[model samples]
Target: MAARFRMKRKGVGEMLRMPGMEAEMLRRAEVIKGVAIGLSPVDENGPHPGHYKASWETSSTRRGGRKRDRAVGYVRNTAYYARWVEYGTEKVHAHHVLLRAAQIGGRNQ
Candidate 1:
């Protein structure tokens, strides 16, 4: 059997070749990263804040055919129990800080 359509793979430069588009994408990623970095909730009930403070990260690059999809910004906790805090173990309850952070970051972008 043969396929009815053919599509060529695109490279990063070909996708982000527009004027200043790469810079703009990086800037947007930075904006989202900043928001995420500051978004971890501070609460005595949650895990220690140090891990949450150090884990925010961002990445930007040329990919796909659209400028809006090239940036990636995310936050993470390095604590041993970060998952427990986010998802909760049987004895713990989910704090949902990451989920909230993403929501706020999306709104800010």
Candidate 2:
């Protein structure tokens, strides 16, 4: 004879409704939101990327003959985030999973 154990599955919304789960979810949500919004443009140098140049110019002519010229240059650097992994026998919460997902998604983009 073989022994079998039954497993239960809970929906994300259902898990979050639990007493303490809600707070955890909220806290994690805030962390994710902050990370996403705070790190809009990440670069050590400036807005443009390296190995490239940008410029702007303007000219005008009138009865008096007026002329104007303008130029601009910049380099861009791509943003990146550190990779994280969790390992242990400690219990894992739903909110933690959600927060991790948020962090991963934000970093990837």
Candidate 3:
């Protein structure tokens, strides 16, 4: 996303007006790096007990309306956002490499 500025002429009097100078001040903003971890039905189960089965199962209760289940699922997705890492972090970088390797291995299989 970017923005552009332009001067428009309104009348003959406006034409006689001097053009105002436009200056753009650019700054180095914070760079954010992120990785999306998508889980398939075929990912390997780690040594952590109950991690694999728990990851695939629905945590929402069957009680109440369908909207409740939908809301729960949305909340679950938002919870995954905490797992995303900003740039310049070692943990995130390592996770990225592991995810890539897993994807490639899956493809080969």
Per-model lDDT = 0.60, 0.33, 0.27
State TM-scores per candidate.
0.51, 0.27, 0.18
In model 3, pairs of residues that clash are none
Highest lDDT scorer: 1
> What RMSD, rounded to one decimal, does every model reach?
7.9, 24.3, 18.8
Error of 2 at 34 (Å): 1.5
Model 1 bad stretches (over 4 Å): 1-13, 16-26, 41-49, 63-74
Candidate 3 regions with alpha-carbon error over 4 angstroms: 1-46, 49-53, 57-89, 94-109
**True lDDT of residue 71, candidate 2:** 19
47-78, model 2: which lDDT tens digit per residue? 54321111111222211112212111111212
> How good is model 2 by TM-score?
0.27
Clash totals for all candidate models: 0, 4, 0
Name the 10 consecutive residues with the lowest summed lDDT in model 1: 65-74
Identify the runs in model 2 with alpha carbons over 4 angstroms from their true place: 1-16, 42-101, 105-109
